[model samples]
Target: MTKIPRGTIAIEEAVLNPDGISWMAESATLFNTGADPKKASSHGHTPQLLDIHESRLAKMDAHSVEYMLLSLTSPGAQGEPNREKARKLAADANDWLAAEVAKNPARFGAFAAVSMHNAEDAVFEAQRAVKQLGMFGIMLNDYQVVGEGGDAEGKKYYDAAEFDPFWKAVEELGVPVYLHPRYPQTKDLERGTRYGDRKQILGAAVQFHLDLSMHIYAICSSGVFDRYPGVQVVCGHLGEGIPFNLWRADHWYNKPVKKATRPSKEDYSYYFTHNVSITTSGNFNTAGLKFCIDQIGAERCLYSIDYPYDTIEEAQDWWKGVDLPADQKEAIGRGNAIKLFKLPLEL
Candidate 1:
């Protein structure tokens, strides 16, 4: 094992059970993860994704990572079309994660999955996951897939007046909500013919960030933060390209067009700085880290590997060489995550 780093934590790690693999493989329509479950193990990362024991924990130990905050992977329950099935998948997945995390609470924490299809049920499940199962926070894969088998009719994002109850519950619970990424819905995918040439990069390469950033747009532009300002939102891939465009976003939100349509009391950058956090999950570029730190400061940036998808060796290799002061590195690499997520890790 590598020399132990002091209190290092990865905030956006993903986990899924065998049942979830089976379900998603068979039912998944929106994202490529479910494209063909039959060849699931073909990715060669299944052992890493499935085993928190030897493979995962060993990787963490090998890289000097002290702890990991796990969450249901993308297109988890949120991809299910049936509300009841989605609810069950969420509860079961959380329970399974809780059981696994119970085995090594010191090395692992988890975010509970929820179906955004029903605001009320999602609120209840979020409460149960935190209160009953001792989960740390909630995970939402962009939006709810309400349409049966990936149709465009069932798309739902929680930015309207209707999701107030859910937002209110999250604020009351005091746990951060992680806004993770997923592929565009089938309808949007159809419209994405503009990228027909290199559409191969749609899911995780180019479009995943584009797709997830829109939900971030909804969260900010739709006034969810102005009302429940205490609710914390986290995004991977260095703020999902927000920090790079914060200036323009702030300027545009102040313009008449955005001002008339939304109820946000502050500029886009205000809510982003006050209520959101970013992680170095997959995009581990030193320049991006430098830029985000310059834009949002190190306090709102956290370290992560987007594990199984992003290897520990590669993330650690890049993170170890990040050009910054020791204090800033400590803050982003670990301190921020512990404080923001209320992680039980000791400094």
Candidate 2:
């Protein structure tokens, strides 16, 4: 392994609970609150920061990560039942993030939050975040749950025709749309769960990748990729299981179904090559990273820490020793993110 530079960029470092203790209460669950009977007491507040500033610098230094692109945590605007409330929270979160980045422009940047309940609001916020706040892109928490109608049984996806406006805005602004995963709806959440409550959170850690991967497939098969060719979509955790099973996914497309409207060349691999990007977050396996780079190409892979859950030190310790070409490692660590987000490379 080649020596990584002293201060490389880790684009996927997250900034959760911007309102601090208040925001934590809103998103906290029993399992993640460190109240579970299974874990040790020392696991309390795994990524505790004295405050936001201390947290930011500490993790950055620990990982030798010079730049971090902050994002709102899981169940961000996606959990809001009311569109109006969701929109407000989205704006407030973006504003807070922008201000935080502004304090240390070189060291920090952010992905804007959006309320996917309303397509119009999602578009508006995307434009505002990029044009005004100078956000790198938009971070959406998996599928948006709007009323009782927006669950998995409802089959409501953001890539549908009705959500074209959101895609249009993203493409127009020339910013990437990161598809971050949330826990799946109740019906589809059983596969990865082991026990009861423990299963929910643990299942999330594992299954979110699968959920987002399926969403990517749905979008592509539904012709969303063909329609919005200019827009770039990124997924965390090594394309969220897509690369590992891509061959199988493509095999499914080969079996003749009914009349397929999309072009013959518009296969799963086409979307993988043309539209998608991946990040190495909690996944630290060297072989997996190398395999992903081989399958998807190094240009589409980015480095991330999945901070708060996976620490910067652990991530760096693993990443710094991964066996790959020097150029590929550098690209995964920083170059790809810079090119993808059009981030300023002053430093």
Candidate 3:
């Protein structure tokens, strides 16, 4: 029953377009086996995810969330087979989200969804979203699926040379791309882990973050930051469990069995400290948050309520009860988010 501090900002909340306004219908079709991928993906078209009216505002007020940074639900436009289709979907989704944010600018901000299937279109859409639509930043749902129909085998990673233009665009745009998690169906199939089979269990809980952590590490190891030091990447769920095992990864990198020329000048931890940030989204573990703060410092850690997935009340209560100084709590609750997203708050 602890009261949330005033002016708290909640990033990483998701929205659902139940009336076929955005790309949900098309993108949901990609996962043919699921029970209406939209419902399966977002715990069904809940009132919270679909509501942008008083219902949503009421929830925010109840939780003392001043602003909520919203994005499209998972596998959004990223899993589309056709690049052109993906481009259109991304544009439509962003446009819809922009309109929603425009309604209540004081209470809502947005993350642009770009078509990662086509690098050129992705850059163009990102530019349009940030420059024209006035989105706070971009949110990529894990890795992108590349290739034509029935060719969902190919995948796109940010660290690859092919994504250099996209990375360069992000750096130039000066907007942090929140690297959010999506379940890796291909990995589940290859490893026979049944993540895809059990959407209720593995999609959000296990395989999603695991797949994203590897992608995050790939970006770190592949020297993406070395080339574009200005760009910032964000990982949710307590660094996707990355901060806890940095020493082991760094040690292995320092003494590689098959040593070769490395792309990055320093190790993964260096980039994490310099160019990466983590959020307490969907993860309310106080011990984990303390460990992450200890590892990366509170300045690089932000707070978010994974709305509709985790209640804003729950997040607020947990954050309120944490055994930290008021300044440190404020940094995690609002200051870090404002600094990272460059929120134009009048405070």
Tell me the whole-model lDDT of each prediction, alpha carbons only: 0.82, 0.74, 0.80
Reference-based TM-score of each model: 0.91, 0.86, 0.89
Encode model 3's per-residue lDDT on 47-120: one tens digit a residue.
56788767778877876788889998777777665788778778988999899899878788999988887678
Please list the residue runs of candidate 3 whose C-alpha ends up more than 4 Å from where it truly belongs after superposition.
1-5, 19-43, 149-152, 186-201, 256-259
How far does residue 88 in candidate 3 sit from its true spot (Å)? 0.7
lDDT of 3 at 290: 94
Q: Higher lDDT: candidate 1 or 3?
A: 1
Best model per lDDT:
1
Residue-by-residue lDDT tens digits, candidate 1, 179-231: 98876545555544654444567666677788788889878887789889899
Pick the winner on lDDT between candidates 1 and 2. 1
lDDT of 3 at 76: 79
lDDT of 3 at 263: 71
The TM-score of candidate 3 is: 0.89
Model 2 TM: 0.86
| Native-referenced Cα lDDT, model 1 | 0.82
Selected candidate, larger TM-score, 1 vs 2: 1
Report lDDT (Cα) of residue 147, candidate 1. Answer: 61
